[model samples]
Target: MSEITPDLVRHLGVLARIQLSDEEVQSLTGQLDAIVDNIAKVSEVATPEVVATSHPIPLENVFRPDVVQQQLTREQVLRNAPDQADGRFRVTAILGEEQ
Candidate 1:
């Protein structure tokens, strides 16, 4: 059995900046112990030849090939703008600077 003592839980709470009550600490200790045991069992079955994967099924990128195509001109893009300056969209200064 993995050692999941109350003192360990208390130390973890302190490091995590959480105020855990005694009851909560006691509950978590058992839950965490079970989780650790499960992980240990899984590790025991894992072999050196077995491939590691993040998902159960094979994955592939389902994206279209990147290709340059005809795009809207700057004039067409800025046509709906409320304000324009120097061939670019203009907005109010927001750096607390007087404009």
Candidate 2:
């Protein structure tokens, strides 16, 4: 397994635009080394015959029947609006002219 050196960590930090202290770089080097080692082990076990799966359990499409349902009347839909005009909800103007 390859070791993650401080130089590698510093390079990664530079690429990611992350400012890291000397101690932080050293600490992250060790952590990243362990993670790489674990990934190497996982990669070794993956075989050509084994199919890759996104989800562990089998999945089935669950769909509801498309049936038209009753809808609220215009008055019922607009009942809770604080302001309304011309059978629709009224909203305040969004833009103003430059002074």
Candidate 3:
């Protein structure tokens, strides 16, 4: 079993942008060590014949039948906009460049 020390915890905290006190570092070291040990045991069981799968169950793509639908007219579409002018939806200037 790998030993997780204060130095390791402090290094991890710095990498993750976290600040930990001496007591917190000690506590986290034990917890992290146990987690690493468990992971190591799991890795040991994995074999060459067993393919790694992200999900436990196999999945298939589900597709719906394609169908044509009526779309809104330009006037109707513009009606929903907060600002409209000259038969079109007028939007505020996005870029700072002058027109």
Top lDDT: which candidate number? Answer: 2
lDDT of each: 0.91, 0.92, 0.90
lDDT by residue (1-99, candidate 3, tens digit) is 787888999999998889999999999999999999999998998989888988999999999999989998888898789999998878888898543
The residue-level lDDT of candidate 1 at 94 comes to 88
Give each prediction's root-mean-square deviation over alpha carbons: 8.6, 8.5, 7.9
Between prediction 1 and prediction 3, the one with superior TM-score is 1
How do the residues 1-99 of candidate 2 rate in per-residue lDDT, one tens digit apiece? Answer: 677999999999988889999999989998999999999997888889888887999999999999999989999999999999999999988788342
Report the number of backbone clashes for model 3.
0
Task: Please give the lDDT score at residue 59 for candidate 3.
Answer: 95
Point out the higher-scoring one by lDDT: 1 or 3: 1
Q: Ten residues in a row with the worst lDDT in model 3?
A: 90-99
Residues 19-63, model 1: lDDT tens digits: 999999999999888888899998988889888879998899899
Q: lDDT ranking from best to worst?
A: 2, 1, 3
Candidate 2: misplaced stretches above 4 Å? 59-99
